[model samples]
Target chain A: MTADRSSGPALAVVGATGAVGSVLLPILSQRADVWGDIRLIASARSAGRVLAVRGEEAEVLALTEDAFEGFGPGDVVIFLTPPEISAQWAPVVTTRGAVAVDQSAAFREDPEVPLVVPEVNAHAVRIRPRGIVAGPDCVTAAMIAAVGALHAEYALADLGVSSYQAASAAGRAGSEALRRQLSLVAGTDLGEKPGDVRRAVGEDTGPFAGPLALNVLPWSGELREGGWSSHELAVRAETRRILELPDLPVAVTCVQVPVLAGHSLTVRARFENRVDAAHAREILEGAPGVVLVDDPAAGEFPTPADAAGTDPAWVGRVRASLDDDHALEFFVCADNLRKGAALNATQISELIAGESA
Target chain B: MTADRSSGPALAVVGATGAVGSVLLPILSQRADVWGDIRLIASARSAGRVLAVRGEEAEVLALTEDAFEGFGPGDVVIFLTPPEISAQWAPVVTTRGAVAVDQSAAFREDPEVPLVVPEVNAHAVRIRPRGIVAGPDCVTAAMIAAVGALHAEYALADLGVSSYQAASAAGRAGSEALRRQLSLVAGTDLGEKPGDVRRAVGEDTGPFAGPLALNVLPWSGELREGGWSSHELAVRAETRRILELPDLPVAVTCVQVPVLAGHSLTVRARFENRVDAAHAREILEGAPGVVLVDDPAAGEFPTPADAAGTDPAWVGRVRASLDDDHALEFFVCADNLRKGAALNATQISELIAGESA
Candidate 1:
């Protein structure tokens, strides 16, 4: 283990040039009082790139064990890399005594690693026996925070959700690829015939199975066992873990929409007891970290355009289920980069720093 | 009443210059053996336009009482017009002794006017005592044809559905407006911030509350009492009517995606008995007007791109809900014009013509 540092926690941000990282740096700078000495680290190829943060320029450093050399027990190392990279480096950093907060699927299911959403399960962060705290996937992070508040008040029985995911959730390459296809088909009359848009955007489909310019794809993540898409399984697993509903009956169908930032979901949630829309709206309105924008007649409701770049989950369209007295239907949207990924990691990092202090 | 013609039933198409009409014309020509003389009729403003059908030019006639002058018993007039126009003209044609196949919501809820999805409830078409047969809405037409087949074998108790609707479901103006907004935002970096796309497409939000380019609107049709959009109400009402489940418990959340033609839905249905994926697939593969394309590893799934201009509802992503033995989840897609609107109306008209013959 590395020698302990008596000073306040420093932050080493791995994958500092990634899609979520780009958004993370800005948020960190805006919440500058949360830490001391922030280190920007990325792959060797992006090491020399300069990024602006809080009116200061920081040159990206190559990611390696040496990058965390000065990061001791009091310091926190945050990983925003893909699953493989996170798996490799999480133990590396935590072994050297610095707490590792992983934003990848690498260690999310690890029994010793605490899978956390600050607003939903901050207590889970304190029980990190492996010195590793794992944030939920982008979809789960947004959904859990929104519903966890309600779950805390009214015990949830089961959940049925359909997601409208944005392109940015696939990272920078995904957003760029979706934009390229949009530009290609935006000028043509490709939406008229079968496979027209798909043919027009051939090979530029980019991280998606079909053209998303004027379409929605019902699949996300790699195909997995039992015919579940990686995303479908992840959503079910992570949400179940974070909500502490070990055996919760959660049904999730993830669909990729053309939005570039926010991830939206339509939720039909059943509670242990009867729930009313007005009371539910009241709970959501007063709930911390959730914005209630559900006045439909006034044209106020959550949309990706309204939620992008925001930290709070925008909750709207609250109505009691027509057939069930104990259920409610609502819509939720959060900036996939902010609350869904970067901000949640930032929140977890701050929680660790507070504990150390 | 107009004089009864001994010649086989003449086919008259109202709203023959709209988006569904543009698709309906070709379908009618391809199925030319179903009719004798075909009359194209539209509002006065669209009269005199020459449209080609069955390799022959047909002049558009002004929609007036005289437009149906020679149409009588055994003759069928299909109304592909707006709900308001269908409401105004449906009784006029039916009173003149012509079977009026209305593809609008105006007559759908009327007990005498059967709302039919041909594959699901063709027998309901014969019970149109008011001489008016109404087809289901675009979203319902696509989904009912898919699920109703399964419901026939396994009784459905409740359904949870979320629709990913195409812009053309809003008709030509809606689609043109959506395409225009898409063109405006497709070239801009408008998705990174709140209201950026809305600002970029200022005042071009046309028919929809917000810009649909690279985004989705959670509400569709008019905002109704109890905060349910007209679409949400229509989906529940129509699905129940077509499936012959007068009190079937259905929860629907309709979101307008950016697709131009096909409407897709993710449905979770609770049945009266146990259901499995393999059996469901086998059932769907042989079900009339349903195409089973659920092999995900081979990347065979339904998207609007594949369903556009297709006649059958493409079913995919079938899985049994993990917690419920009686529940099944699946995704369905179909051309909103072909099966959703024009084709269903055409089918109903043919059924009426066949009975009269």
Candidate 2:
């Protein structure tokens, strides 16, 4: 059955019950009405459930071969599912003639599948040979908008990033686990001694390596080669691809903090030319999708708590490196479920929609 | 009124009522007995208080010009006081012929004073021209052991560090503020929105620039010239001085996390020689004052909670940088009060006492 094309192209959101998808639904409703029909698709478990989108209740559809029967050409299907799921189904969605804008790591490293950060490399989306546009992971997505803006003005040469990632970056399970762990540790002095927190949070670490309630875990994704976590390498690869600096000399350390939402990153970037802090601040002040909240003297700087539920990546603690005139250091935070995943995917879909127009 | 030096040299601990002092008293009792009298000195407010040391209760003495009267040569006075207090009283203690081992930033940069990390620069304590031995700040003290160990093997060329500093790094008030804030926000689901945390923690941020509960503040210490925090520059300066590398390139970003005790750092170090992850792990495992807790596959890496109350700096997540053969990245954690402050001070004092013996 062909969906009506008179209104606009149809939009299908896979994994609609997941963390990123939950944020994406509200974002789509809140943003411009560019889609003809918003289709919510999730696992069979969540299929019969009704969710609110664009302030209207919509019944979720189950994932199957027929899910994308009528999603063709101008229609955009966004997969906020796990990598294996996206890898298996993204090709199916694209085979049906719809462009799949995947927010999974599966296609991000695929050269033919353009990794898009709309503000940074929206132009790359037009040349997706695999008919799939991949979005950077939450850590990279949280800071890329600001990093890209700075790179534009200063010509970024080398990048070093350390992330304070939110539990939600691991999906709903991670957030729920953190909440559970917090309840177990709240109003207690569990963090004072060795293994005390672990003893209190016995065997319920959820998606993390250990109890993340009163502690910061340095390990993020699966351990990759050379002891780097997959998430760390993804940040490096995604940043390189998005900024078109394949050999940008990027080093990243991904750590999971106890935060429930926003992902924060401390970025150290070396530029080809001498960088001025004031000029960089001015550039960030005017940059799209970047907010400069950097008045340290007045107690103003981006914290995950302040940046959560926000769309733009909040940048602060801006300073030129003391040892290198060409380097700049700053802290940035953005809601992992929003700008870090949902909004970036939404923006890419909008770009594709505009292309069809 | 000279202390009986028959048992050993007299030891004075100023700021005995403060955070670091609270930890120091326990350390003195636990370590091998090396002193005749363990003097507890604090402000007049805590002058009447008694604290335990070497299995006995010791009366706290008020800070005065005469507090050092009985403390002469062969005696060591350890200052865990604020910089201003140390600056005001260290000379007095030294004038009476006692060696003053200060854990404040006041004398750290003094040309006549030697900044010592006993494990790294124990010999430097022998040449204290000002009769003052300065200890590095908590953040620097926490990671220098591991960094110094690695440098000894590879000859470090450049350093980049991002800290997950604990609340206690600011002092007892910072920890109290975090506990109070945590009680306010715990189990209430408050971190999902912007300023909700700030609203819940109104005017109760204590020593921090903003709410540290469920948030990470990128700024620590006083804002310095060129947009650097005093704490960040201190890490750079202290690391350089302790390593005896005056021209080493170092960059640091100090951030306050909600963890109550231990401080964590993600480090990127470039060495003159090529680094191997397995070999680095072997080196760290055998290095003095360093504990290797790596092995991400088994869910064993250093987290603040696990490292809290420990004397050794826990090093983990060892990996040679994929891009640079000479660079290595790792995460390290240490109790900010113990290894980061109290223990380091005690170790320096031990060295000073050994000098007289």
Candidate 3:
């Protein structure tokens, strides 16, 4: 049943030494069915590092235009670097007939690129005219994948999102660094100064900009001019794009909770098309990569603590939202590393194998 | 400073065996200068129990007519039982010629019963129509205490609220049970049937009614015919009441995060009056019990971790909500056990002391 390895697309991974790439290496290396000759690429600091790819040591190569010189045409390349780095070099890879599956923000909004979540909208992967497959932001990907499953049964008109995101989305440094500030906040010697929350503000100055250990922080990222944070704006735009709601009215407040991994969202979606709770449940039950963990009667739900290492976006708390006939409320959780980033990037690569290579 | 102890009002606390009672017990007893004489009452289960009150071991008495023998007219009572129990016994406590500070759903909607959060509407406590100072729901007290402080600076037209609550709000049994289920969900072995969130649905059923340890349950209670959960409806109604916005439209989603204490809210208040981020920060700085933790340059914010054992509602993320002109978004975290319930109930008693008993 083994296919000829020479006929498959050669896979190249960018940013192999970084946060998500550390997990990506294991997943990509183990996924030999879709990858031909795998290449591990990182920066100068990690140039000589070796990763276990398909149980063999794959030497990490520095990311450069010259690095792709020996690779054949129509190869599949996965980029986990920053948007600027991926944007600057993605074109070079694509120009040489490589299908670029990006985990960065580079090609997501580009009209020519198709930001695809294979579980939600796999059909979009087929129309990547620029040889680039963009992965949605982790929160956006986790949400759209869950709600999209519900949309199959009903049409959503208004979207209200409240995100409980972990510090991890800011990357390994931000989340890990938060561990200190959070512990500090939690361990604050309130000692009967009436231990007000504002005092924690006076105690903390680094990493999280505030304390994060045991508290819930509603403010995340810098406040944009219009009051939205970078995270909030990304959610609104990315959701609109993925749901194909060009001018959809979406309201979102993205908060940074004290969780260590995964992102959880409290969403109330109103659809123009009416579908009762039972029908909606049936749709989610049949949806791909959607784990319906919503048995509220017993207090079952989908939280980051539960979704940390899981591949699917764990969705629950599904029921009606408001008094409106069209609205539905649900909670969604996904391991930002897996479904939000690495797993999605890997899923897009399968499409790259089907398309360019 | 030593006033005649018998000169003040004789106070009684019903449902003193509950979580809120557990916290209020020490606050009321140890700090009785704000009060006169204190009596601890509970259900038959806790009747014989001896709890430390006012630095003395007070005998817990069952809530019977005989308990009201010495405490005659012009005394005070605080009911901390469930609504079903409170509704049945509130009138009884009030009829005993005492001001009843009730912490139940009993009289929240009753026009005669003043829903009170001492910070926002402590003056409202002065006019207990039916001799009952209604302690608001924990959700309302925490939000209104914070938002009411903000409301003084600006007139809000509408509000968007998202609550990150703990299981303790459901009761001590509910909280302890959610903890047990979470342990099971995390430690349980979900074998080949992994992708399905319910690898073993009935394997671990605790007080949460489902697996709640690592999950976010969106429906805090049963979804009524109209769709909103009991928690959601109560939050919305309580917000409207506490803010004195009978017509103020609030779209709310109550999501239960797996945190043990503190209820955090991500709120977007759309004001009728013009307000800016800087002005809001400036206003909140001087607002009672509010501490400005907004410093985006350093990634600082107020979190539940920081708000854990604090007495005040911690507010941060004071910015706008998307493109709405009237909208301002913020994060609020306060110790659910303290500010959300017990501390609030204790604060209400302070108002009782201000009166001639």
State which candidate has the highest lDDT: 2
Per-residue lDDT of model 1, residues A226-249, tens digit only: 577888888898988888899999
Count of backbone clashes, every candidate in sequence: 0, 0, 21
Instruction: Estimate, for each residue in B176-284, the C-alpha lDDT of model 1 and write its tens digit.
Output: 8888987888867878898788888897677887788877789887888767888898889998888889999999999988888899999999999889888988999
Query: Which order, best to worst by DockQ?
Result: 2, 1, 3
**Candidate 1 wrongly placed segments (more than 4 Å):** A1-7, B1-7
lDDT of 3 by residue, B185-257 (tens): 3323321122333343344534454444434445566655544567677777877777788877676777766
- Candidate 1 interface RMSD to the true structure: 1.1
DockQ list for all candidates: 0.77, 0.80, 0.27
- Candidate 3: docking tier: acceptable
- Give the distance in Å from residue B199's predicted Cα in candidate 1 to where it truly belongs: 1.1
lDDT of 3 at B164: 85
- List per-prediction Cα lDDT, in the order shown: 0.87, 0.89, 0.71
lDDT of 2 by residue, A86-203 (tens): 9999989888889999998898888899998888888898998989998888889988989999999989999999999888888889888888888888788778788899999998
CAPRI level of candidate 2: high
Which model is ahead, 1 or 3, in terms of DockQ?
1
DockQ for candidate 3, please give it: 0.27
Q: Candidate 1 vs. truth: CA RMSD?
A: 1.8
Q: Quote each prediction's TM-score.
A: 0.98, 0.98, 0.82
Report lDDT (Cα) of residue B327, candidate 2: 94
